[model samples]
Each structure stands twice: as C-alpha cells, then as structure tokens.
Target: MSGGGTSPDYVFAPHERPLLPGSPATPAHPTSRRFAYFAIGVFVGLTGGFGNAMVTTNLANIQGSLGLYSDQAAWLTAAYLMTNVSMSLLLVKFRQQFGLVTFARIFLPAYVLVTAAHLVAHSYTTALIVRGASGIAASALSTLCLLYIIQAMPAPWRLKGIVLGIGIPQLATPLARLLSSDLLERGQWTVLYVFELGLALISAALVMLLRLPPSERMKAFEPLDFLTFALYAPGVALLCGVLAQGRILWWTEAPWLGYAACAAIVLIAAALLIEHNRANPLLNTRWLASRDILRFALVATSVRILLSEQSYGAIGLLTALGVGNDQLIMLGLVMVLATIAGLAASAITIDPANLGRPIFWSVALIAVGAFIDSHATNLTRPQNMYFSQALIAFAAVFFMGPTLLIGILRALVKGPNHIVSFVALFSITQSIGGLAGTAFLGTFQVMREKFHSHSIVQSLTLADPQVAGRIQSLGGAYGKVLGDPSLRQAEGAALLSQQVTREANVLAFNDIFLLVTVLSLAVLVWIGIRQLRMYITGVNPMSEVLAAMARTRGQ
Candidate 1:
C-alpha cells in the first residue's frame, strides 16, 4: 500500500494508504458512524442518479412546458451527457490535487444552484446550460458516493460497498418512472425540480456535517493536462451529440452530423497524439490499447447495447399499446425490487477467481427475458411483462458490479496513473453504448414498422369477405351517430386502417424483441468460447489484479 516504488512523483498519506493509492484519506469508523455513513452514501448516490432520471423520464412533458420541438428537447439530454462523460478525465486529478473536502465544497453548491436555475429558466438555451452543469455535478457526486460507501464498510466488506454504490444508480430510472406520475400530478414539472433541489440541499448538509478525512495534496495538475483536456472534452461531447440526435434528425439527412462527426474525430485524435508524446500523459494510451482492456470495453459496451431490450423495446411496445407511466407503476416496483435482489446476489456470490461467470449468467437471463417478451400481442399490458422485465432488471444490476471490479483490479495492478484511463474508457463505453443502442433499435423498429404496415395494407382489399365484413361492422357502429351513409363508411374504413397500423406496430416490436434475443445469445456464445479457451489454457485474467487488490486492502 505504500506509494514508494510504483510512482515516486506522487505519495500517499498514512491514513490514505487503505484507500486507493492516490485517493483522499478515509478513516475507519465505529459501528454507529458506519451506519450513518451508509445512510448518507445511499442518499447521495440516489440523489445524483435521480436528478437525470426525472428529466429523462419526463422529457415530453418538459418539452411541452418549454415549447420546444422533439429534436431541440433531445439536446437537453445531450447537453447533460456532453459534460458528464468528459468531466471524469479531470475530476480524478482535481481531487488528487485539491483534496475531497474542497471538491465537495465547490461542486455541491453548484449542483444546488443549477437545480434552482432549471426551475426558473424559461428559455431552452439557459435550461441546456443548467443541464450541462448538472451533469458535471452528477459525475462528482457519483465519486463522492463511492468514497462515502467505502468509508461506511469495514475493510473486508469494502468492495461490497463499491458494488452497492455503483449499482444503486441503476435503480433511478425505475424509481423515477414510479415516482414521476405523482410528482407531475401534484405540481407539474416544477415540482420535480423542487424535489431534486431538496435532495441536493440535504446532500450538501450531510457532507458538511460529517466531512471526509483529508488526504495529502500535491500539484497533480500540469499545463499539458489542461491541453489534453481542452482537446478531448469537446471531442467526446460532439460524439455524444451525434449519438443523441442522429435518430431524431435521421442520420443521413442531417448535414451537421457529418461535420460534427468529422470534427470529433480530428479533436480526439489530436488529444491522443498530444498525450502519446508527453512525459507524463493525462491518458495512458498504451495501457488502454492493451488486449485485455480492449476486450473489457467491448464486453461492457455489448452488454449496454443488449440492455436496450428493456429500455427501448419493451417500453416502446407498451407505449404503442397505450400504456403510460401511471399504468406501469407496479411494473416499475417489480423491476426496482428485482434490481435490489440482483445487487445482493452479486455481492454475495462475486467470484474473483472467475469474474466472467456472473456476466455469462446475466446475458443468459437477458436472452430468456427478451425471448419471453417476443410473444406479446395487442392484449399485452405492463402486468403481462412483469416477470420478463424483472429478469432483465435483475440481470442488469447483477452484471455491472463484477464487470466494474474486473477493470478496477486490473487498473490497481498497473498503478494509479492508469486509473484515469480506466475511468474515461468506462464512461465513454457506457454512455456511448446506451445512445448507440437506442438509436440502432429505434431505427430498426421504424424500418420494420414501415415494412409491416405496407404488408398489412396490401392484404386489406375490399374484395376479401373478412375485410369487407370487418369494415361493415365498424360502419354499423358509426351509423347511429351519422345520418350520411357515405360518411359513416368512410369513418369505418379510417378506423380499420388505424387498427392495421396498430397491429403493424405490435408486429414490429415483436421483431425487435427477437433481435435482442438473438444478439444476447450471440454475445453469450462469444463469452463462453473465450472462457472455455482460457480454462483450457489454465489462465485467469483477474488473478494477478485480484492478488494486488487483496494486498492493498490488507494494508
């Protein structure tokens, strides 16, 4: 745990040695203090996640209030991600140099102020800025949540705290969907922001009341660091923008997407080129380009993509069937509980000897859940999806902890400098993977819907007996309301067409579900093959890193 031989330039204080090598000191607490720390850790973690969750879940309503178009409203989310994904690159260094107390003192108030600004800002531009700032604050809060949770636990159980801290945020989307109906019903959009502001104030108060122990400080920032950040931050932001808005604007149709994408490539390449030549690089490109790290990123990104089964496919299907958040409250509750269960299961059964096993099982569960959902019809409701969605939900939380631990162990073994690279790699893979998944699935859904619609329309000839009978039956209902025979017939035909469209949408969603099932199965097979090969070779990728982590934790 001594910061002696690995990196002589940076040293750890005695109290900080138990924590990450370059992290702030976290003193072990008594039992009562540990309980309090756990409570605050949960609160702050949920708060950080809930802020973005509320906004994302209620985007349509927020758009209506702001009088912005769908594409413009999407920018709000894009803005949040723009800063959120990029800030991790520098925030680690900020804490290393300035101390955790200083990091909290500045960012917590900024988060509160941004929440307030969101309430009062009537214009889209101002709101976008506020959201961007909130994203930066959120990244900081996530770090704080991990640190506080680590402090809450006894040494051996500390890794479990990390698992819970990371997994808790995944609950926000389901929690937001469950709570948003009541918030909107009681006080409209402003009420949601008010609730978020209250949480921020409480988090700020808790942090100030019981501060993290201070750590050794040094001049962690260098001129080259800012140079790399300046180039890299906006490059990632533009890439995020492209992913967020590509579907809305229709990829090939938007000219700016091409320009933005080109600019992003140039800027990111320039940043990496600068980092490559520096004596002390901000991002350790060599480590990131390693085979194991690349594989980890690929697996993580693939899982995120497959997770769109719940986020896009099932939800899109329900929305098409006239199900709303109000009707899905029970479903959300089921998912939240299932997620908590998964987190517990993962913590209890996490095997450092074989980290890939849980991930394998999680993907298998996703495939099962998606295959189950592929059988839905017009009669399908949120209640019908409870079990399948719960399986997916369980798998979602179950996989994340071990996936993260694998990377963390690897980074720890390498040295503290590689931590920044791992963080950046993780954030980009997750954020971009989500955006890519939604865009890909959504576009596929649209294309299938069109094809299905055309096929259904072609078969509905007036000459067919069943089609004629159905039209007549529909017209009969309108006969009592309309005196004109022709008008009633026209109305009935319109109704029949509407039904055809609805059925087409249902069929398209079924195709989407089947696609997810196939993709999940493919990923599972790939991972299984890799695991089998490793087993035959008698190689465990995590052994060295886990040994290193265990040694550090023991100190």
Candidate 2:
C-alpha cells in the first residue's frame, strides 16, 4: 500500500492476512493464531502500566540512598511525565512513517536500557537522569499496544479490543504495587528496574513474533518543530521546579520561585504567538480558538491535578497518623480493590461515546468524598482510611476511561494538527494542574503545621505558676526528661509534651484536609458555573469549533 517504498510485494502486501475472525479471517491460518497475537499485545501493555508504578514507588528509595534533594529528585518524575506526553506525539509521527512493529522494536530496547541503567546508576544525578530516559521508552508501550490491536482486529471487534487494551493496563496497578512492596522490603529500589528490564526483553521478543495488518503500518514521519520544543522545555522545567519546591516557595510569593514562574509564563505566551503565526505550527491555534475545547481542557485538567495532589495529601496524612510501611503496603492493596471495581464498572457500562455525563457525576462524587476525608477526626481506625480511599478510587473509575479522550479527539479531528494538538494541550494542562495542586496543597500543609503547632503550645499550661515553680526547683531537670534526677517528675512533663504534640499534629493535618475539601468544592462550583452558562446558551465548549468546521465543509 505504500506508494514510494521499493520493498517487495510480500514485505509490503504480506500475501496473506491472519484469520482471527474465522473463515475469511482464517483464509491463511487458524483463528487461534490471530487471537494469540492479540493476547500477547494485551500482556505487553498491561505489564508496561505496572512497570510505571514499579518505577515510581522505587524512586524514593533510590533517591534517598543517593543523597538527592528535592531539586534533583523532581526530575525523576518530571522526566517521566514530560517524555511520556511528548513521546505520545512522537509515536504518532513515527507510526506514520515506519510500521508499528518497527517502532515497537525501537521502543522496547530503549525501555530495557533504561531499566538496566537504573540498576547500575552509581550517583543521584545518574539515577535521576536515567530514570527520565527510561520513561520515554516505557511510556510508548500502551499507545503502541492500542495501535496494534486497532490494526489487527476486524472493524466490528476493534472497539471491543480497544476497550480491552486500555482496561488491561489499569488492572496492572495492584500487581505493580505488590511488586513495589516486595522490592522495597529487599532494601534498594534498583531491583525493581532490573526485574522490569527482564520483562521488557520478553515484551520485545513477543513483538517480533506478532503478525499485523499492513494498513495499520505507520504511513510517514515528520520532524518535530524544535523551536516549539525549546519554548515548551523551559515551561515544563519551571513548572516542575515549582511543584518540587512549592512547599518551601510559599505559594505565589518567595522571590526566586515567583520569578521562575513568571519567566515560564512569558515563554509559553511567546510560544503561542509564534505557533499561531507559523504556516505549519506545532500547535493548532485554530482549534484552540474554540471555546468548548478550552473549557473541557480546563475542567478536565483541573480535576486531574486536584486528584493527583490528593494522593500526596492522603499519603502524608497516613504517615502523620503513624501508618508503617507494611500498613501502607496494605493501603495500596486496597487501592487495587478500587481498580478491580473500576474494571467491573467499565465492563458493564463502557461506551466511549457517551462519557460526558458520567465524568461530571464522577467528579461530583469525588468532591463529596474529598469532603468526607477532610472531616476525618479519627485516624486510629483503618476502616475510616480505607473507606475514604476506596470512595475516591471508585469515583476515579468513572472519570478515567478513554471515552472522554475519544470525545475530545472526535471534537478536534477536523483541526490542522488533530491528535498532536490535542495531546500537547492535554499534556500542558495536566502538568500545570498537577503542579498547582501539589504546590498549593503542600504549602498549605506546611503553613498549617506551623500555625497548629503554635496553637497547641499556647493551649498547654506550661507557664502556670505551679509548673514554673516546679521547674525552677528542679534546676532545668524537665529538659532532661529521660536522664533527670527526679525521673518521675521529668516523665510527667515528657508525657504532657507528647500529648500536646499529638494534638498539634492532628490539628495541623485536619486543617490541611479542610483546605483540600474547600479546593475540591471550589472546582465543583467552577464547573457548575461553566456548565450552567453552556446550558443556557446552548454553547458546547468542546464541539463549537469542530461544529463550525463541519458546517464549513458541508457548504
């Protein structure tokens, strides 16, 4: 089917298509042979998603042992997120030029190399850098698997296969978490990477054995607009920097940090202008001009970011309440239950075309759950924590299907850059939302800690006349709570202090949760306002521009 290629007919046309659908599909081979290849693709995609969690869980251990601080350690995540998003676009272009098999061949080895690099990284810098590189390769696994499935299956089964492809990887979360626990128990996190490296090799071997249809092969390749990337990089770096240090940066202030943020904004503004003017711009300015897409992007991005930051809050609260590593591992296990629940729900009502109402309702549930979590007064009970976490996870299942993504893509299919533009904007919004949530919530936590600590100290009676006189007589014995001559008296003071500190920590965490509750509520309010406006005016921010394009084409 490729016009310019000089390759032989057997190589290009492949004399025979597989017989997966039976009869016509089995003209050359049995139905089982075709299903087997699809099964292998599913396995590869599922493992890749699991590998994402494996790498993330181990990052803490790897950084801690290597003495990496927040500044250096931030890249471990930034690199992965950036490469994953950017590489999504890159894969689109590559698939246009080379076959899916060839791209898979290239990506799998790179992922394996990254896993290997993690195993041998001697210093913090090397490990951080290598982890970032590995993300690019690992991120491609799911997208490629989708493309493979879409090409292999006949039309009627393609949607079912796509749904299966996406669903399988999500199920990998619990398994990945399980592996993470085992790896952490053995000391260093590098072992997780070593395991993943072996897995990637197996994936690569499987790819070699799979047979796919020719039309699904990539059509052509295009070079990236480096100028656009140059602008995007600084924005990404600045945003990541803020998220990593925002707790210390003091929200929107803190001189140096604010300056970095300002610079990033300026750079992005310039990129927008440059791209809008260029004939073949990196971003599709015309599509962005659409009001609906803008609104959906903002709302979706906001919800995702808030949800992501909530993860940090949940983990922090767990630690504050003295949940041990083993307990946390158990908590993570509960999340798997959520994943299973999500899968089951998706199986029952998983239409990609009609996801808007479901997504809206899911966000509402998540907001309510966040409110419940905020008001949690008792941390001693595992049931309380489990209930809150499970609720959020259940809510997430409604929000995180390919339906919304498919909606957005269909909404923008008539735009100049199509998927590439959709992806770039999607990535940018997600990154920003995540950073804002994390930084805002983190700083809120720190400030709450300070405020609550002072409040608790003031509530104590340490300055009472009786206490003062006892301290004076003891000649600073209270300071040496453990080693004092009057051990009984010192122990009493120590106990009093511990009680005060415990109250203070609880109050601080409570305040932080309240702030999160308010934020989530605010998001709901914002969405409600926008939705009301759209409903009143019959203005769909998602499809307005796409609708215009359709009208123009018809005329």
Candidate 3:
C-alpha cells in the first residue's frame, strides 16, 4: 500500500487539540456552526481547484509567450504538482506544533506574495520559482481545509465532505476551459492568478471568523527527524523526476539520470525502513500495514494510472489533432456533468455496501473510453471526435465519483496517519503513473511509426512487374502535374513518402488505443482477483475500521 499524505478523514478523531504556547485554545462549537466552517473550507479549496486547472489548460499559451520549449514549459506544472505532493506531510507536523490558526496566519501572506509574483513573472525560471513557493502555501492550505472539514463535520458527513472537496477540483477543469477564452482575451494568464489571490483573501477572512475546536487542534511538535524526512524528499523528487523524464530522455542514456533515480529509490527505501524502526518516525508505517489502508493504496494506484492516461493523454490527443482553443475550452467544460453525477451518486449511496460496485464499473468505463480515444485520429469527422470525447467525459464521471467515494471511505476507516500516508503515496504514484504512461505511449507511437514506415517502404520498393508499373505510372502523373521532365522522379518519390508517413501515423495511433484497452482490462482483472480473494476469506475490506483501534495500539 502507498503511504504519502494524511487522510483528511482523521480530522474526525476525538482527541483533544493541543495549543501553541501563546495561542488561545478555542472551545468546540455546536454542530451547526462547525458545519458552516466546513462549508467555507470547501469554498476555498474549490477556488484553488479552479485556479490550478486554469493554469494547467493555459500552459501552452504561457510557454509560447515566455519562450520556453516543451520540456522547460513542463517545469511550471511539474513544480506546482511536486510541491503540493511533497510538502503536504511537512504541514501535518507544523499544524500540530503551531496550531491551525497560526499556520493559516503564516501561509496567507506568503500566498498573496506568491500570487503577485506569478502575475508579473517575466521568465520561465522566475515563474517556476514563484510557483514553487506559492505551491507550498497552497498545499498547506488545502490540507488545512481537509483537516478542518474532517474535524468540523460529523463522521457520517465527513466522507461526503472529503468527496466534495476532492471532486471540486475535477469539476473545475471543464469550467475553467469554458472560461479560457474570456481570460485569454484579456491578455496574459495573470488574470487567473488575480482571481486566485482574491479567493485566498476571502478564505483568510473566513478563517479569521470561524474558530476551530481545541479538540481538533494538533499537539506541539517535537523536533522532527530531519535526517529521515530529508531522505524521503529527494527520494520522492528523484523517483518522480525519473518517471517524468524517462520518456523524454530516452529512458536509459540521459547523463546521470538513470543512476540518480536508482540511488534515490534505494536511499528512500532504506531511510523509510530506518525511520520505521525509530521511536518517532516520519511516517506511521505500522498503521499503514492495516488491511484497509494497504488495499486502498493498491486501488488508488490503479485509479491513478487510469486518471493519468485520461487527463494527460486526452489533452495531448486533442491538442495534437489541431483542435482550436475554443474547442479545447468546450471539451473541458463537459466535466461538470461528471462532477454533478459524482455528487448525485454520493448522495444516494453513503453506506459502504455498494461503494465498490461503482468503482469497478467506473474503472471499466474509463478503460474502454480511453482505449477508444487512443484511436481518435479521424479528426476530419467532427461527429466521431465529439462521440469519443463525450464517452471519455462520461467515463470520467463514473470513474471519479466511485473512486473518490471509495478513497474517502478508506480514509475514514484508516484514520489520519494512514490517510496522510495514503495521499502522499497516492500523489507520488499517480504522478509517476501519468508521466510513465504518457512517455511510454508517446515513444510507442514513434516506434510504431518507424516500423510501419519500413514495412510500407519495402512493400512500395517493388522489383515485381505490377508494382514497378504502378510506380512508373505515378511518376508519369507527377510529370504531367509539374510539366517538368527533370523533376518528375523526385516529385514521385516525395508523394510516395508522404503517403507512407500518413499511413504509418494512422497505424501507430491504432496501436496506442489497443494498448490502452489492454491496460484497462489488466486493471479490472487485478481488482477482481483481489475482491475474489477477499470474498473467499470472508473478510470485508471496509470492515477494517473495527480493528483500526487495535492496529493503532499495536503500532
């Protein structure tokens, strides 16, 4: 099982909150007031989601204006994502040591400054630096929102809140895309960040007004084992970097890249083992061994792989087909349907009984839809393209709603420690999965094209009488069009080469779709086997919450 970030569901724990030395300990509020606070957190988190997605969709335009190449332009997105994923764990200790109020107070100002920096960012290097710092604050704030929501809401409502909190980001993509035109029309992507900063200001106001229960607060942190966390950070960074770069750097021969990746993984694993044996570990690995969290991590890994393929792959395919900016906006806009569907699905199904069913079916839809999308090269047929895009959107609704619900349920079952680890591990794995899938698929497309070209060329270079006559005839036609006797041979060769390239491209794309199908099927089989084994053992995975207390004690 993957162990990464804290589970927001752990906020529901009834432990008394500890206060900072000078900070006032706030009394717990009535359920009504607490729910109101939870709502505010959702609003702030959703706002961030909207801004984050807008920045992602607008990356291409940002690169064009800033003069960054494809790989360099990627740093903006990668930096933000990496910071968010890596630093979340750090906040867990800080939130405990400083108190939520104090942490928010610190992050708020930094957030404003970073947002402003992005607005006036002049170079790729500068923008990434600014984004990296801003991302740290954003990550802390988001985790705070999750922690607060879990603390404020009742147990029954906690899972749904987490689901909505997570779902908001997924839903925002389409909405942001729909609004991309108006934002882009205003010149530069600065306008989006301005809106984000405004939202942050609003969140700051809400945070000030709404007081949290002392019971929900964290205890003062002891001195961290920096030696251990230090090991984990670079390890995670390298592992993700290698996966992200492997496809780009040709996998094996990019300087010290491969060696560094191996070393990082080895070091990180060793450190984790060392930390796990320590009295106060960076991660609570003992709690992580519980069946629920471990199984949840496995499921999350699969879901992430699918999500990576869908989001990154879909975006690249759409852009590659020469889709207009307006169309791209509309394409993303369709996700609202899925988000709404997820929300509705959550409302009807709260008990853990039917949760896994939706997850299974949704993943199936994602696999099938993505596989179809891989074969989506008939861009001239608008109907066909829309059909493919719609299927993907619909599948996303199924995939996201169910998977998110299951994750929240798992977090609820596992508690804060496991939740944190799960999220951290989830982020790390999903990032790796997406980068790996895109790179592999991209390289596969290239390789397929080369093979198709060779075979088709060999077929074209005929010593056979019939093939030779056809080639000569094509040369004659080319001579007629150019009316230049000397240039006829070269023109005929160029025409044949163009035709071969086009055919090769189509075949390569088809192979990508076939591979996606195989991936989806493999996921189903894996999940199915696990479920069958659980059934045979007569142990409900969701039932592990009953033993969570036992697991904690053993740890």
Candidate 4:
C-alpha cells in the first residue's frame, strides 16, 4: 500500500503514471488537509528564496558590516548561484532515487544547520561555504513547493497551483526589500542571517509535522553521474564567478577572470562530451540542442535578461538618485502587490490550449514599462517610478507560470527520462539567465556612463559665460571657510564636475532602459511572428502534443 493510499492506477495504466520516477503520489485529500498543504507551499516557497533575496537587497550594508571590498562582496551572490544553478540537474534524480518525502526531510534540516553555521561563522570563507550549502538545500524547496501545491489543488486546477508555486518565491525579492530596513535596524547583517535561520528552523519543523505522500524509489544514479557532476559543477561555478565579478573587477583588467573563463569552457565541454556518449545521460545535450528546445531556451534566457530592467535598472537608478532602502519602501510595496496581481491574473486566465499568449503579453508589458522609464531625468524618484515598475513587476510573475507550464508539458510529451534535462534547462535559464542579465546590463551601463561623462565634460568651457557663472555660484558656498579667490573658484569647478557626473549616470541608465525596451519589443515581435506562422499554416506540433497529454490523462 502506498502512503498516498492504494497503488496508483499506473500499476495497470502505465501511460497515466507519474511523469517521472519517484515523483510524489497524488492521492485525494480532505478539504482541511488540502488547505494545510497550500499553506505550507506558500511558506516553503517564501523560505526558499528569502535567504538569497535578503542578502542581495542588503549587499552594500553586508559588505560594510564585514569590511569586504566590492569584488569580495560579489562572491556571496556568486557562491549561492554557483551551487544553486547546477543542482537542479541532479535534484530530479535525487527525488527519483530517494522519494520526495525523504528529499525534503534531508534538505530542510540541512538548510537549518547551514543557516545556523552562517549565524556563527564570521569569516568570508565560512560565509561563502554556508551560502553555497544554502543554495543546494533551497533548490529542493522549489520542488517541495510544486508537489505540495499539487496535493492542495484539484486535478483540474493543478496547473494553477504550479503557477502559484513557481511565482511565490519571486515575491520574496520585494518583500525582503520592504522588511530590510526594519531587520537591519534590529541588528547589523547578523540579524538578516538570524532571520533566515529562523525561517529554516520553522520550515524544517513543518516538514516533520506533515509529510508528503510516498513515491516509488528507483536505482537512479550511475558511477558516471558523479564524474559528470564533478566536472560540470566546478565549470558552472567558475562561469558564475566570472559573470558575477566581471563588471565589478572590469572584465579586461582581471587576468584571473580570463583564466577562469577558459577553464569553465574546457570543463563544461568535457562534461558534455562525456554525456553525449552515455546510454542514460544526465543532461540530454542533443535534445536540448533541438530546434524547438533551442527556441524555448532562447525565449527563457532573453526574457530573464530583459527582466533585469526592474532589478538592475529601476533599483539602480533610484540608488543613483540618492534614494535609500528606507525611502523606497512604498515602491517595493507596489511591486509586491503588483506581483501578486500578476500571479493571480496568470493563474486565473491560463489557457492550456494557448500557452504562448502570456509570454507575448509579458514581453509587451515589459516593453511598455521600459519605454516609460527611458524618459526619466534627474528629478525622477521612486514615486515617479511607481506605475512603470508596477507594470514590470506584474509582467514578471505573469509570465513565469505560463512559461513553466509550456516547458513542463513539452517535457512530459518527450517522456519521463527527459525530465532531468528539462529541469536543468529551466533552472539554468531562470537563475543563470538572471545573473547574466545583470552582468551584461551593468557592463553596458558603465561603458555608457563613461561615454556620457566624456561628452558632457567636452561641452563645458570656462570661456562660456554660463559655465563660468555656474562654477562661481557653486564655489561661493565654500567662501566662508576658504577666503582665497582661487581656492573658491577651484571648489566651484569641482562641484560642477560632480553634477556633470551625476547627470551622466542618469543618462546612461536611460540608455539602458531604452535598450531593454527595444529588446523586449523585438522578442515580442518574434513570438508574435511565430504564432502568426502557426495560425496561417494550420499545423502545430504543440497542438498535437497537448492532445497527447489530454489523451493520456483521460485513459
């Protein structure tokens, strides 16, 4: 007898069985039990993302509190992602071999212990170790979130549950921002770790209290799996390290960055070469490189990069404008609320027959928001950004569920073995894609800032009366302390230079917004063209695949 109840019908009907090995059984539950499952899903999803989100929002504060340099601080994020991005490749297999209940029990408790270690460990090395451990553990919770939500919803609404489950963690980004000022006030960076520890503890306890239904176990791992991981893990870590530190250290100036990049290429190529010959490969490189999968990967990665408009663009602009976390509380609140609405909207309106539509709308909404933000000036503040940011926030969660569903359905159509490959593709596109977006945009902004700075400085001449007068007015404020006329004039010129630098930064950010706007529109057009082609041809592979899925469930 299965813990979920009787043996699954898949015992007789193989076609309708769990899509992948060791996936949680979906037994019927009472109303109260279902509600409890939903509640746990929300909490665990929040916990999964809170650790990284809190650290990211308060990076500068954490850096100062630890006496770390700018480049050193970037490692904290890089460490988390280094492990986080590649774990999904193995996590599906872990669940397959062990079962979801065991998987949760193991990772959640380890999460608590690692978090506590972080609380006690003050050194940079220990912090990086703990952060990386946290990533491996938290990757499990996203799976937990999905399984719990599946148990909560009726069979018909399970897709909605998937949407909510995937999107719930995204809420943590803005939520962390909203709560950061208060948490830091409670204590320095330690309080943030303390808070994360508390969440991990509660989550661990909650899992022990209510267990997931039993899943059938399998002998999923091979000796070569370990070898593949050894090479692949470090390759990805090095790649993530390079991306995280490139702009901070300036790509060309850092010799190690070049060495790391070359090493990453070799290691990853070797791993894929090994997998390419395996009868049961961990990563299906050939499948991933297929035309349809390639398109999906492109869209997934590009959208994530463009979505950096909110994280690296809007937040960067406000920070440049001298706004602090405390001042931007309301903006964060607006994003949180808008994100909730987006999730709700996506869930309620999901059309399994037309999964691609939300992606189109998401890109369109982002394009519009970025266009609005491209017009910002020195006078712009968080309040000025409320609407555009809200629109982008709404679009952020709005597309996630549908995007995921498209991938999920497509993977299921390919058969059970492909599940690991799909998880890897999806996770990489979401996590690594976000990091790449920030790195690319940050580098673009810096280069543009230099360009604008030079252009603005070039336009200024002392012979221009307005320029000389502005300098005199700025220097006048320093007159009480510096009586020398030459000193006052020099001070005036310095102040003028500061204003020019600030304006140049603002202009550079506007260029980023415009670049994002154009990219978003182009992607939207590409998706639109594909949809148009499908309609005109009256032939669709996706329609056939969806029909197959419906037929399997019906049987």
Each model's lDDT comes to: 0.86, 0.61, 0.63, 0.88
lDDT of 3 by residue, 1-555 (tens): 111123353342223322222122333557787777668767666665654576777878888888877767766766776566677667666665555566767886677677778778888788988867866877766665655565565545655655555554556666777787787788777777777778777777776666444323445344555666677777776766666566556666687677878878787887679767867555667766667557766776666666655565566555555665677654555565655665556545645544666666666776776666665553533334455555555555445445555554555454554445555665654555555666677778778879988998887756777665665666788664777754775666666677677677666766776777787788788777767887899876566643564465456
* Model 1 C-alpha lDDT per residue in residues 260-358, reported as the tens digit of each score: 999999999999999888877889888888999999999999999999989889988998898888897999899999999998998888787788999
Model 4: lDDT of residue 535: 90
- Per-prediction backbone clash count: 0, 10, 14, 0
Clashes of 4: 0
Residue pairs whose backbone atoms clash in candidate 2: 19-25, 19-26, 95-218, 96-218, 96-219, 96-220, 97-220, 292-541, 292-542, 293-541
Candidates 1 and 2 compared by TM-score, better number: 1
Error of 3 at 135 (Å): 2.7
Location of the lowest summed lDDT over 10 successive residues in candidate 3: 16-25
Model 1: worst 10 consecutive residues (lDDT sum): 1-10
TM-score of each: 0.95, 0.81, 0.80, 0.96
lDDT of 1 at 2: 20
lDDT pick, better of 1 and 2: 1
After best superposition, candidate 3 residue 495: deviation in angstroms?
7.6
On residues 439-475, what C-alpha lDDT tens digit does candidate 2 reach at each position? Answer: 7667777777778778766755756876655544554
